[model samples]
Target chain A: MSGRHRLRALGALVVLNGLIPIRTQPFYVVYLLASPLSFLFFISVLSSGAFVPFGVTGGLILTMLSAGTGLQSDMTHYRQDLKFQDIVVASPVEAPTYVTGMALSELVYSTPGLGVFAVIFVVTGLANLQSIAVLVGVLLLVWAFASALAFTLATYLRDVRETFMFSPLISLGLSVLPPVYYPIDRLPHWAQTAALFSPTTYAAQLVQGSVGLYSLSFGHALLDWGALIAITAALFLVAAFKARWKEP
Target chain B: MASAVVAQDLFKVYPGSHSRTPALDGLSLTVPTGGVYGLIGRNGAGKTTFVRIAATQLALTSGSLSVLGHDVAREERKIRERIACVPQESRPLYFLTVEEVVYYYLKMRGLPSVEARRRTREGLEELSLGEYRRRLVSQLSGGLRRRAMCAMVLASDAEMLFLDEPTTGLDPIARREVWAAIRRASREQRTILLTTHYLDEAEALSQRLVLIERGRRILEGTPGELRGRVRYPYRVALQEGVAPEELEPYGRVATVEGGQTLVFAREREARELARWALERNLRVSMGPVSLEDIFLDVVGRSIDEDTPAEDAEPGHDEAKA
Candidate 1:
C-alpha cells in the first residue's frame, strides 16, 4: 500500500476503535459499571445465568481486545511503512510523552465503549448514578493502562506475525490467571497471592470495588491504584529502553 | 569553524539469528561546517546505517559519533537539537496536513507557535508546496510526499541535515529542484550529508565524495579528484556503419554496444588513441570521465544495473513536491 493510504487507514481505525465497544452482551455491559471487582461479578453472572449488571468486566474485555488488535496492527502493518519510533528518537520527545500521546489518541478512540456502557447502566437501573460516575472514571484509567501496555508490547515484538501470534496468548493468560473474572477470595490463598503480581488483577479489582458491584476496603483500592501507577511507570521505562527507532 | 559532524571508528553490527552481519565496519568520516558531502554506495553497503547512527536514531554497536561537538551517546538530546534528518523511505504522518507536519516538527524543536507557522509557510513556499499547505500528507502523490518530508527537516533550522537517498524517485526536473533546495540550504551554512545512487548527482552537488563498497571506503576525494583517478585512455564511440575489425588496428577495442567502442591506454597515450580513432574516421567521444564510470571501474559494478523494481523512479510525482 502507498504510505498515504496506510496512514489514513491508521487514523480512521484509531477513531473507530476508540468510539466503539466490541460486544453488546448484557453481562459485558454490567461488567463495565462494577469498577475494580466487576470481573468477580462477571463470574457470578456467568455461573448463575442471572441478569448481569454492566460493570468493569465489559470495559476490561473491550479494552483487552482493542489493545490487542491495535498492537497487532502497529506491529504487522504500521511497522513496515512507518517508523513511528523515529519521531521519538530524532526529537526531544521522551518515551513518556510518546506513550502518553498514543494512549490519549487510543483513549479518544476507545471512549465510545465506556460511554455506551455508562448509558446502558443508567437507563437499565443496573447501576446507581454515583456508581456510574466512578465507573466512567475507572474506565478511563483502564484505557490508560491498556494503551500503555499495548504500546510497550508493540516496541518489544520485532514484527506483526510474532505479535499476532503472541498477544492473545499473553492476554488470555493475564485475564484468566489474574483476579479479572472472579474474586481472589474464591481462589486458594496461594492463588490469591499470586494474582497480586498481575496488573490486570489490580485493575480489575479496583474497577469492581470502586463501582459498588463488589465490596472491598478503601485501603485495598488505594493499594491497587498505587500498583497500577508503578506498573505504568515501569512499562514506560522499558519501552524507552527497548524501542528500536532505527531500521532493522 | 567547528566541524558539523565528526565520527571515529563508527561501527555497527546487526546480530542475525545465528551470526552477525557487520553494517558499518569501523567507518569514519567527517563533514566540514558548511558544505555538501555525498556518500555513495550500493544498496546494503551500510550507507543508511551510517546516516541513522549519525542522526542519533540508532545506537552504535561500537565507536564514537558526534554532531556539532555533542557526543551522540552521552548528549543525544543536545545532538538531536542540532540535526534534522529525512530518513530513507520515510514520510510524514498520513493523517496530518502538510502544514501540520511542518508545524509539528518545528514545535518539536521548541519553536514557538507563531515562529513555527511562519517557518512552515516559508519552507512550503521555498519548495513550491505552498498551494498544498492544507492538504493532508496521505492525500499527496509519492513525489510530493517526499518533498513534504524534506520540508519538515528543512523547516527545523537544524545545523546538520542528513538526507538518505533524498531524490530516489524524483524525475529529472524534480531532482534538479531538490538539488537547488539543497544548495540553498547549504548556502545558508547548514551542513548536509546526503546519499544517492545517482553518481551524476554526487558529481554535480558534492564538495567532497565518499564512495564505499562492501562496508569499506573505496574512494574519498573531491568529485574532480575521483574523476581524475580514471587512468583509462580514450572512450571511442563509433557510428553504426563502423566495424570492429576496422577499429582493432588502432588499439584494443571493447565494444560496449553495437556502435560504441571503448579504447583503453595509459594516461600519456590517451591523445594518441584519440588521434588513431580520428584517423580511421571512427566517430570518437572523449572527455573528462564522470564519477559514474570511475565508480563502475573501481567497484566492478554499476549502480543502475540491479536496482530493485519497487523503488519509485525519480520524478514520478510532481503535484506534491
Candidate 2:
C-alpha cells in the first residue's frame, strides 16, 4: 500500500480495534482501567496531597506504557496465531504500514483508560486545555517509542510466550523504576542515568511539566521535547525497517 | 503467452533446522496462466515452500522467480497487487463479521469502495457464506471459516491465486463445497497454483499437475498422463477375500482394503488375472487405475527403477501414517 493508503488502513484499524475490546474481551477494559488506578492510589496515599499530580502521572504513564510495550503479545499473536501478518504481508500493504496500524490499534485500545484519566485530571484541576494538548503530544511520543521497540523485538522473537513473558517486568520497569512517582532528584546517580533512556521518564517530565508540577528551565524542556520526538522517530524507523520481513 | 509463475533453481534452507537438508533444493517449474495447476508432494516435499516463495510470502535462498512477468525479488509489490492467497495456517480475523472480513481485505488490496462492497456481497453469496455475513467470524464453524477465507480471496480483483492445502481438515461435504468454490474461482480462467496432498482433489480440480519430492519436480503431467505413467494400464481387484500372494501368481499385487487385492497389469494381463481369480472361485473387478494409484506409486517409489531416490522423502501422508 502507498503511504496514503496505509494511513487510511491505519485509521480504519484504529476505529475497528476501538470496539474489539468490547466485543471480544471486556475484561481487558476493566483491567486496564483498574490496574493503573490502584497504583495511582497507592502513590497518593503514600505521599501527601502534593503527590496527587504524581499519582495522575503514574496512572497515565502505566496506561500508555502497558499498551505500548505490551505489543510483544499483541503483534506476536497477530503474526503467529491469527496469521494476520501473513495475510497482510501478501497484500499490497507494506510491513511498515502493518506495524503503524498495529501501534495505532494499541493506542486506540488504551483510549478509554486515557479518557477516564483525562476526566480525573480535569476534576482534580490538574490540567488546563494547553496541558491536555501537551499531554496528548507527549503520550504520542511514548506510544511510538515503546511500540516501535516492541515491534522490533517481535521480528525475532517468534514465540508469543517468550516475547510477552517480559511484559510485566517491562511495564513495571518503565512505569515504576523511572521517576514517574518520585522526583528525578531523589534517584541515585546511576538510576538517574538509566531514567535518561526510559521513554516513560520523558513522558512524565512532559506531563509533569505541562501541569506546572515541576520547575523547569526553557532550555531543558526544549531539549526534552526534542529528545522525545527524535528518539521516537529513530526507534520507529528501527522497528519499521530493521524488521526482517523476509528470511535471507 | 508467458507462464503465470516461473522459477529456476529455487533453494530455501531454513535457518537452524535440525537436519542440514534445505527445504527446497533446486526446485523449478512453470505454471501457465488461464487454469488451475496442482502441485502434489509428500509432507516436507517443499510444495508449501515453493508456493510460499512464489506467492511472495518467503524469500528464496537462491533462484530466479517471476509471477505474471514481475520478478519476485524486485517487483513483489506489483506481484502482490495481482495475487491473493488462502495460506494453510491463516485464519480470518475473528473480530470482524464475515462480510466485514471480506470487504476489508478487498479494500486493503486497493479495490475501490463500491467495487469492494459489490464483490464482497457477490463472494459471500457465491460461497453461501451470505447467511452468516453479519455474524462475527469467530462464531462460525470451521467449514464456514474456510469458506470465508476463500470468499475474501474470490472477492478481490486479483488475477492469480495461491491455495495451499485448502481442504486439509474439512469433512467430505465441506471438501466438496470447497471444491465447488474453487471451481467457481477458476471459472474466469484465473491462474491458480494449488498445493494439495489429496490425489482426488488434485485430479478433480487441476487441469495439469506436478509431483515434486524433496523440493524438485519429479513426475508431472495431465491426470491421464500420470495415470498412464505406470506400465500397467488396468487393475484387477479381487471382489472378495483372497491372499494377495495368490494374486502374485497372476501379476504384481497391492492391497486396497481388508481382503481386497489389486493386481496391476496390462489389459490382457488384467483379463487373465481376473479369469485366474474367478477359476479359484474368487470374484474380481477390473478397471483403469486412478490418479491416486499413480500418485502413490510415484511417491512411494521411483517411477523408473533406474532413478535413485534422488531426494529425501517428501513425507507423503501414507508414509507418515
Candidate 3:
C-alpha cells in the first residue's frame, strides 16, 4: 500500500477503536483514570508527601505502560472474538500499519489518565521545559515497547480469555517489579542489576533524572535513554516484521 | 470468460499435536469473473480454508493459487486492494452503530469520507438495514448483525468479493434481501465467490457450482448441468412405513431422517412408484432431481448430516485453517 492509503487506514482504525467507543459512552474515562490515580493516592499517603514526586512520576509511567500492555486484551478480543483482524488483514493495510494503528489507539485511550499525571507533575514543580520533553520521549518509548511485546504475545493466544489474567501479570513484571514506582538504588546491588533487564527501569530512571527526583551523573542519564531506545526499537522490529499475521 | 481465481493442486495440512490433518487435498477450480461462483461442501471440507487462502488471510501448505491473475503468496497486496471478504467467522464491532460500522470500514479501505458515506448509505438501504443504521450492533438481532457485516464489505469498491456463508443467519425475507444485494453487486461486473451449505441457495444464486468432498472436487458444472449428470431424472419422497426393498426395483432407495424414504429413478419409474404410493393412501411427493440429490449421489451422504456442529456455532472453530 502507498503511504497515503496506509495513513488513512491508520487514522480510521484509531477512530474506530478509540474515539468512537469512548465518545458513545463518555463515562469510560473514569474507568481509565481510576487505576493510576488510586495508586498515586495510596503512594502519597504512605510516604506522607515525602515521595510525592515518585508517586507522580510512577503514575505517569504506569499509565503509559498500561496503554501498551493493555493491548494484549484488546487485540486478542479483536482477533479471537470479533475476527476484525481478519477483516483488516484482507484490506490494503499491511501488518505494521495495523499494529501501529492499534498501538496508537491504546495511547489515545490512556490520554486522559496521562493528562491527569501530567497536571500533577507540573503543579508539584517536577516538570520544566526540558523535563517535559524528556518525559514525553520516555513515555512514548515505554508505550511502544509495551505495545510491541503485548501484541506479539496476543498473536500466540488461541483464546481471548487467556489475556484477562495474563496481561496484568505482565504489567506487574514489567512495571511494578522494575523500580518504576521506587528508586532503583533502594534495592541491593544484585537486585538493582537484575532490574536493568526490564525496559521500564531505564524509563523510570530517565524520567526521574530529568525531573531531579533522582541523583544521576550526566553519563548515566545518556546511557538510560540509549538503552530504552534500543530495547523499544528491537521489539518494534519484531512486532512489525516477524510477528504472525496469518494463522499457522 | 476470464478467470478471477485459479487454484491448482491446492493442499492444506493443519498441524496437530499427534497427527497432521489435511484440510484440502488436491482441490482445484477456476472461478470465472463477473458471476456468482458457489463452493458447495460439507463442514470441514476445506471451503473456509480455500476462501481464507484466496483472500490472503491464510497461507496454503502447498499449492499454486492466484487471485485476479496475481500470485496469492507474492502479490497479496495487489490482490487485497481489489478483493473484499466477509469471512464466516467475522462479526461487526458491537460498540459501533450499524451506520458507523459500514462507513468506517469503507474509510479504512481507503475510501474518502464523502464516498464512503455515500456507499454506506446505499449498502444499508440495499440490505434493508437503514432502519437500524443508528442502533448499536449489540442491540441488533443475530440476523441484523450478520447483515451489518455484509454491508461493511458490500459497500466497498473491490472487484472480487469473497462471501463465505453470507446468508447463514438471516431469515427467509432477510436472506432474499442479501441475495438481491449480491445480485446487484454481480451486475456491476464484480466476481463473487460464495461458499454455502444451503442447496437451494446455491442453485438459486450460483451461475456455476463446485461440489467438494473430503477436500477433493467431486463435481463442477452449472446447476442445470450438474442436475443433467444425475442418472436419476426424478426423486419421489415417500412417508414412513415403506420398506427399502419395495422401491429397490424402481431405483436407488435410501431411508432418511424420520424414516422417510427417498427414491431416485427415471421419470417413468418414479411416477409409477409415486402413483402406487398415492393409491395406497401414502404420502408421496415427486419432483425433478435437485442439486441436493446430485450431492448425495456423488458424496454418498446428505449435506445436512455431514455439516459439523462447529460450522453452525460461531465460537467452536478456533483454528482458522
Q: Estimate each model's TM-score.
A: 0.80, 0.91, 0.95
DockQ winner: 3
Give native contacts recovered, as a fraction, per prediction. 0.24, 0.42, 0.64
Which candidate gets the maximum TM-score versus the true structure? 3
Segments in model 2 whose C-alpha atoms lie over 4 Å from true places? A2-4, A28-30, B241-246, B249-251, B279-281, B301-321
Query: Which lDDT value does model 2 have at A7?
Result: 64
lDDT of 3 by residue, B1-321 (tens): 769999999987664412234577799999998989999988767788888889998777898999999999889889988988898868998899999999988888888888999999999999999999999988999899999999889999899999999999889999999899898998999999999999999999999999987678888999988978888878999886687877899999854668788899988999899989989999999998889888888778889875453322112234531
Q: Indicate the docking level reached by candidate 2.
A: acceptable
Clashes of each: 34, 1, 0
In order of DockQ, best first, we have 3, 2, 1
Score chain A of each prediction against the true chain A by TM-score and list the results.
Answer: 0.67, 0.90, 0.95
DockQ of prediction 1: 0.20
lDDT of 1 by residue, B5-51 (tens): 78788766554311143566778887788979999988767687778
lDDT tens string, model 3, A165-236? Answer: 787788778877888887898899998999989999999998888888888788998999899999999998
Instruction: Give the TM-score ranking, best first.
Output: 3, 2, 1
lDDT of 2 by residue, A1-248 (tens): 66656766676556455555467777665566777888777777888566888888768878887777656677776666666666777777777676777777777668788888888888889888868888888877777788888877776665677665777778777888898876788899998999998777877887888788887677888888987888888887887677756533
In candidate 3, which residue pairs get closer than 3 Å at backbone N, Cα or C atoms, i.e. clash? none
| Candidate 3 residue spans exceeding 4 A from truth | B17-20, B239-241, B256-260, B271-284, B307-321
Q: Which of candidates 1 and 3 is the stronger one according to TM-score?
A: 3
Give TM-scores of the second chain, every candidate: 0.87, 0.89, 0.92
lDDT of 2 at A76: 73
